[model samples]
Target: MNWTLEVVVVPVSDVDRAKEFYAGRLGFAVDHDTDLGGAGRIVQLTPPGSGCSIVLGRGVVPEMPPGSLKGLQLVVADLEKARAELVERGAEVSEIQVVGQNPRPVPHPLDNVGFVFFRDPDGNEWAVQQISARG
Candidate 1:
């Protein structure tokens, strides 16, 4: 048996607004926007090259305070490029911060140490880390 995280349900106040933020601003691909016909609506979006998808819904998902989710992380090959792309996409991402000591030095000192953070419209926090090569 294999355990894989295929989806994460993100709590949001407005499904449409969240959809726009994830799909329009963050550049996540909209997988589907389905209406359940009096039950609720479900919108799924996936990041580029990511197998896991995020779900934002109204009346069809778990109940949690909007913006309560935090510390969701993403790994990238280049922190600087990823930050730049996020900024270009209109997301207010934090400056790249090098935290902790690098176990092994890579071509870029920031590799394995560099990180950037941002929040969605509902304040769900996400961290992006640079990991060009994994040991």
Candidate 2:
């Protein structure tokens, strides 16, 4: 048996605006946008090469205050490249910072320590960390 995290429900105020931010700005692929008629709408998006996907919806998901979710994280091989691409796409991302001491030896100094942060339109925060080579 495997406990896989296939989807995360991101609460947002406006579905269309959030969709544009994830798909257009962050380069996440739009998996599907389904209109549930009286139930609500569901929009699923997945990051490039990611196994997990995020679900955005109106009324079809659990009740959580929009923009209240935080500390969502992502890992990348190159922090600089990822940060640059997000900046180019008009995302207001934070500067790379060494947030903590690395637990294990890594190939690069920034690996496991370097991180950048950003937020969605509704202010749901996200962090991107450089992992480089995963052991």
Candidate 3:
């Protein structure tokens, strides 16, 4: 059986704020924003070139706390470029650093070791890693 991951549910405190951050700052495409009346709101966004999308809803998963989601990673060809773009879009991102090495002013001397980090409006941490190539 072939199982393809479709969506990940991101928990956020405010729906509109989270939507704006994802769609506006991060430049994610808004797939849908639907209201189910008593069922609450469902908003889905798709990252560029990603088969898996992300969803956050008012009544979806109440147990998960907003800003608690961590270690979400996005792979990029260039960590510097990705971090620069996100910073230009008004997102505060960390400088490129080695993932599994000691902190330094400028790490990632090795290829495929570059990484940057940032967070959503709800404080959901995201890591952007630089890979020399991807298949």
Candidate 4:
């Protein structure tokens, strides 16, 4: 049987703040944002060209704990363009540092596939990677 992963619940300390970051800054589409009938609220966002969507809200979920992880990789088609846009959107993007098991500055082995890292308002480390397709 073929199975597919669907959702990833990112633990967020503040729902509204997260919504703004994921939606306004990163340009993720808010797929679902609503109040949970006085129980809690939910807000979901999907990055452009992303297969999985991130679900984050307060009290919408209980099991996922808030923490920081730096392993999430979101791929883009153009690294430089993505980095520029993220900066324009007010995201605190870090300078393009070396990546992979061994790392170095840009124009390195991964320059063709550019990448930059940043954090959400909650201090969750996230990366934006771009892979160039040579013509």
Best by TM-score: 2
The lDDT, on a scale of 0 to 1, for candidate 3 is: 0.84
Candidate no. 4 TM-score: 0.80
Deviation from native of the Cα of residue 126 in model 4, angstroms: 0.3
Better of 3 and 4 by lDDT: 3
lDDT of 1: 0.93
Clashing pairs in 4: 98-104
List runs of model 3 lying over 4 Å from the truth.
101-110
Rate residue 19 of model 2 by lDDT.
99
- Report the Cα lDDT for residue 47, model 4: 88
lDDT of each: 0.93, 0.95, 0.84, 0.76
TM-score versus the correct structure, for each prediction: 0.95, 0.97, 0.87, 0.80
lDDT of 2 at 21: 99
lDDT of 2 by residue, 12-92 (tens): 999999999999999999999999999999999999988999999998988889998898898999999999999999999
Taking the candidates one at a time, how many backbone clashes does each contain?
0, 0, 0, 1
Q: Which digits, one per residue and each the tens of the lDDT, describe model 4 over residues 6-119? A: 677788788888889889888999998989887888787888867788888776576554655456678766677788899999999988765555343443355545579988
Superposed model 2: Cα runs more than 4 Å off: none
